[model samples]
Target: MTDAAARGLWITLEGGDGAGKTTQAGLLESWLRERGREVVRTREPGGTEVGTLIRDIVLHHRGDVAPRAEALLYAADRAHHVATLVRPALARGQVVVQDRYLDSSVAYQGAGRVLDAAEVRELSLWATEGALPDLTVLLDLDPAAARARLDAADKPFDRLEAEREEFHVRVREAFRALADAEPQRFLVLDASRPAADLAAAVRERVTALL
Candidate 1:
C-alpha cells in the first residue's frame, strides 16, 4: 500500500437508537474486508473492558444518573476507548468502524438532557485528545419511526432508548445541527430507506476515502 493508504481511516456511525447504524456498519466492514483492508469494528461505551463496565452503568443502570455524571461516564469511556483501542488500530493502518462517538454524547447528553452542547463536545475532545473521525455517517430517521423500529424488534430498551419521545426529538435535532455545522465531515442519509441503498451510499463515500 502507498504511504497515505497505510495511514488508515476513521469512520463513525451516528444516529438515534434503532436507526440501523449497526446494519450499515456491518455492511461497511464487510465491504472493506472484501477489498483486503484491515478493519477494526468497535462501539462506544462498550468497546473495551473498561468501557463495558461504564456502559453497564450509563446504559443499563436501573436508577437515574445525573446528567453531568452520565456525560462524565461517557467521556471516561471515550478516553479509555480512544487511547487503548481506536488510536492503536489506526496507527496500525486499520480502518476503525466505530458505532458511535462524541457526537452521540453531544446529542443525547447535551440536547436530550438539556446540557450545554458545546460543553459536552469540549469535554469529549478533552477526553480523546481532540480525536475526530475522517467520516461520520449519520442515519437520519424520525424519532417516532425509530421508536417504532425498536418496538417491533421486541427488545428491551436501554436507559437512553427508554426516554420519552421529546427527548429523542431533541437528539435528532442535535444530530442534524451537528451535521449541518460540519458538512464536509458528515454524510447524512435517510435511515428510512432500504439497507442496501444506505450501504451503497456509505460505500461510495468510503470508496473515495480509500
Candidate 2:
C-alpha cells in the first residue's frame, strides 16, 4: 500500500461519560507510540484552543441551551477540529485517536435531546467535510453503571452528564444502534469488563489496522 493508504488511520473512541474511554485512549496512545507510530490524541468540543472555549459553554454553561443551538456548537467545534487538528495530523500520517466525534452528537442531541438524528449527522458531515474515522471503538455500558462511575469521581456533572437517566439510556441505545448500522467501522465492547481487557481488545483491533 502507498503511504497515504497505509497511514492516516483515523480512530475514534465513543461512548457515554464514565465509560473509561479516556483511560483506554491513553493506553492505546502509549501502545502505538511504543511501536514508533505518531499518535494525535484529542477530545471533542475541546481539542483545539477554540474548541476548548466551546467545550466550556456547551458542557459547563448553567442556563439552558436550545437543543439545536447545542448541536450547532458541537458542529462548529467539529468543523474547526477537523480542519485544524485532525486533517493536518492525518495528512502527516498520524493516528488520530479522538474521544468523541459526530456519533456523540447524533446520540446525545438526536436521541437524548429529541432532535433529528439524520439531520444532526448531516450537519456534522458537512462541517467536517465527511471525514469519517477509519475505526470507531464503542465502549458500551449500562447507564446506571456509568453514572456510578461518575459519582465515584466526585466531580460536578457537566450539562450533558447532568441529564436524567432516561436521557442517558437513549444515548446508549443510539450508540449501539449506530455501531450496529456500521459494523465494519465499529468495534463494540462491553465497558463493564476489566479495563485491561478492554484496552487489550482495543489494541488488538487497532493493531490490525496498523
Estimate every model's Cα lDDT from 0 to 1: 0.95, 0.94
Distance (Å) between predicted and true CA of 183, model 1? Answer: 0.5
**Per-residue lDDT of 75-166 in model 2, one digit per residue for the tens?**
99999999999989988889898999999999999999999999999999999988899899999999999999999999999998999999
User: Cα deviation of 114 in candidate 1 (Å)?
Assistant: 0.3
| Candidate 1 lDDT over residue span 69-178, tens digit each | 99999999999999999988988989999999999999999999999999999999999999999999999999999999999999899999999999999999999999
User: Which residue runs does candidate 1 get wrong by more than 4 Å?
Assistant: 1-6
Alpha-carbon TM-score of each model against the true structure = 0.98, 0.97
Least accurate 10 contiguous residues by lDDT in model 1:
1-10
